[model samples]
Target: MTLNSNFREAYRQAQSQDVIGPNVIPKALPFVGGGLILTALGVYGGLGVISNYPNAFMPSFWVALIAEIVLFFVARNVAEKGNNATATPILATYSLLSGYTLSAIILVALSTSGVGLPGIGIAAGGCGITFIAARQIGSNLSDRDGMALAQTVQLGLIALIVVLLGQLLFSLFGIYTPGWLEFAISGIGVVIFAGMAVVDFYIMPRSYKDEQYLSAALGMYLTYINLFIFILRLLIAINGGGRD
Candidate 1:
């Protein structure tokens, strides 16, 4: 049988089980944990970047946005062709290239602002470890056969609507959220990420080919990254202990 056929059969077996379905849970964990880590990184990275070299940092934000859009299409094509393994490697390459922007932000945060390097380092280390763990766990599941084109479009729309609406509300208020609110945001973000991970993990294996692993990885990576950032923001907002 072709890899695609094998992938479908395996997923069928995985889907048949009880208890949240093996096909679903592994993906769920990473989305929650990963999103928290990424969110934290984004906050620190943005703050750090703006603090050290304000101009360079902000532009990368736009650039990262564009890159994500490009990759989204690439991932979709790769998955349609049954190339899961290839998808992840390609995504890693993009991530490596794109990561520099965030790294620049991180460098600025740590070196320019001496707020608390040790604490940040500890948190950063923990986030990295968690990501590695999640990737490994989720990868163990059988491959997804492929999602319907409509489902893919629907998922993208859901993400866009949520993000745009959330940001709009925040922007309209000009509300610098209070410190305690951070925890609440983080808690909510965790729940969202967990659900996202479950959805992605279940969907990816069935829809994507082995060559599309990179694409799936990218999807997984973003989910975790978002989660991380939300968690981090919560931490910073709260830990500051009642901002000025």
Candidate 2:
């Protein structure tokens, strides 16, 4: 079946089911909170380790990135199959690793230019505001509307992927990226991730069981991290690239 059709079926199924007591949001909050805490700890720990042993950056980045990817898929699969016990730990680990990766990027930007901290602040504020607005908008959307928004966001993501690949190819060819192009790509990333956050929030109410809150939190956390990274890059670009 087509993606839209599949969405419709899921929506229908969700609508038909009798929702039990204790809403998904409340159940999800603790997991999300815990994940955020772990993320902060990971970022701090990574920064400390990287500061003391600068040589470890590349290895740590690769290891964290790879481990996070693996754990995310495993956790998602387990969550979908209703194995919350296993999924929760995996999700937590993924979040922690993600934070570590983020710290590396932040530190790199800081070392490169003075815009780093300001960029981070702006990104955090933007993410907070966007998330709140998106959640409100999502909570008010009908399932059909939510599905439509999801499709639109998916298309945006495809465009973002294209931009990313183009940038990668440019880098591989040792071509100099124009400042305008860097700014544009980063802007697109920010917008796409923001839209994705909205869609994610919109679908969450109907997507998972209360017991699967960890999975839901994981989704939100991913969106937030992506948004932060894009925003940070955009800010750095505005400040004239990350170069001393």
Supply candidate 2's per-residue lDDT for 56: 89
Best by lDDT: 2
Tens-place lDDT per residue, model 2, 23-84, is 67667767877887888788888898888988987798888888877787787778767788
TM-score of 2: 0.84
For 109-156, candidate 1 gives per-residue lDDT tens digits of: 344333256545654564566556544644443434223322443454
TM-score of structure candidate 1: 0.53
Q: In candidate 1, which residue ranges exceed 4 Å CA deviation?
A: 1-53, 82-93, 97-115, 121-164, 195-203, 241-244
lDDT of 1 at 48: 65
Off by over 4 Å in 2: 1-22, 112-114, 242-244
lDDT assessment of candidate 2: 0.72
